[model samples]
Target: MAGLLQRVKSKMAIFAHRKARGMLDGEYGSVFRGRSLDFDDLRAYVPGDEVRDIDWKASARHGSPLIKRYVAVRRQTVLLVTDTGRNMAAEARSGEVKKDIAVLALGVLGYLAHRHGDLVGLVCGDSAATRSLPAKGGEAHLERLLKHVDSHANLEAAASRIQDQLHHVARNVKGRHLLFVVADEIAADAATGQLLRRLRAQHEILWLTVRDAELAPSRQAGTDPIARGDSFSVADSTFLAWQPATSAAVQAAYTKATAERDAARKAMLRGAGITEGEVAGSADVITGLFALLERHRRAG
Candidate 1:
């Protein structure tokens, strides 16, 4: 697994890319400017500490004034927030598993942050429970973060419970950071929109949706065959058996519905000042990421 991560890491040679500079606020450096604009830690006030850096509440708690120590402003934190629910277990049109895509994608982002000397963090889970790792830098820390998602984060669960996970991240992560969310396709809705907007207020959110042909039926033609082991559901109708062929009209209707659903989802993200892209299969993984980064660069 570590070897695979290293291969992906190598493909992310962002130094040649102009957008990498944008990650650090257009500075002429290769590193990402971290959450230094936000306070890092609180220590007992020092003689030369700035008065504005003093934490009054901490001072009361310790019976002496304490100073907030912010990490280097040039360093940034990259948090990978993912959902390992059942939907993630589905197979993508590229023939790679969604869970594998998620791991690789996470590896890509984590590797970029690692290369730039930025801290890497994670918040991943399903309906059962959500786990979080505070931002920390280094090869060892990045490896552990990747391993946890590869091993502990399961793919058999039901509800992704993304809203809950979002709230968890919001409450646990301190200050501003670079947040990447990898999850199933989100249907645009008020509740999720509100939560995303709130998170956007405090962090740079880059949305990644794991795409699979099975998830949204295209307008093409006959019913798409659900691979023997690949089954999915909509509402309460679970498709466990292989799918049968459908007329062109049926496929069109399905396509129309999916288009509308996708449009609404995009609209919601736009409203929240978020942009999303897809990671389809193993082959498309690296290319998709580079393309996504290009978009981020242009946006910045």
Candidate 2:
């Protein structure tokens, strides 16, 4: 476990570097959630109070300076929910399986949680079954959590159960925490949206979608047909068939449908107040994680 932690954290060393803001060192907010200060309330200004906390306008209205008080809640819970269905087991353009990419993303964030003194947990499984590690803080505990996620136990499910995992987390988790939902491209099923809405109302959610090159057929013009003897891909694999669209018009229609689907998915996610991070099949996990943290840092 120590060795695995060292290996994965080494890959993320760039992200964990000391910055002027010193977020990782806790001088400012930890990288997970922006600033660490949680606003408590306003009160009469007292001597020795930090000038930045004074609400000048409020003080003018009330004829006295007021200071904003913040209580520190240093520890946070970061729960990772990963989909382990067979689709994730398929090869990515990088030649690594989508599941492996998903695990890399998980490790990057899990280690970040540990760095920030946050409790990390895992909820990984597919349609068949699920396993969870209760949120705990520690290098050893985090390594264990990562190991559980890296296991094949959840990857053997016969079908995708992303929605099932979402539902489980929504029902089981309580209070404010960070939830990372890792899956292939967003299918945006009805239940998924509804469950996400409910979960967002409780926990802060970030969606990390792993995209294998094969997911987008239009981009695979240079790639071979689905298979030599097979016209249609296997039920669980990429659905693209070797045959081209019946006609130019049919191809155009398919393209339009695909575009519309992508647009709708983005719109739905926006409405849910959830920002998404996408990692290419072959992209470096550390680089992908830095991009996600930058976006999150700005937004938070």
lDDT of 1 by residue, 200-245 (tens): 9988878888775553333343455443343555223376443332
Candidate 2 at 187: error in angstroms? Answer: 1.5
All candidates' lDDT scores?
0.71, 0.69
* Alpha-carbon shift of residue 197 in model 1 (angstroms): 0.7
Clash count, candidate 2: 0
| Candidate with the greatest TM-score versus the true structure | 2
Count of residue pairs whose backbone atoms collide, per candidate: 2, 0
Best by lDDT: 1
- RMSD versus native structure for model 1: 7.8
Span of ten consecutive residues with least summed lDDT in model 2 = 20-29
Prediction 2 global C-alpha lDDT: 0.69
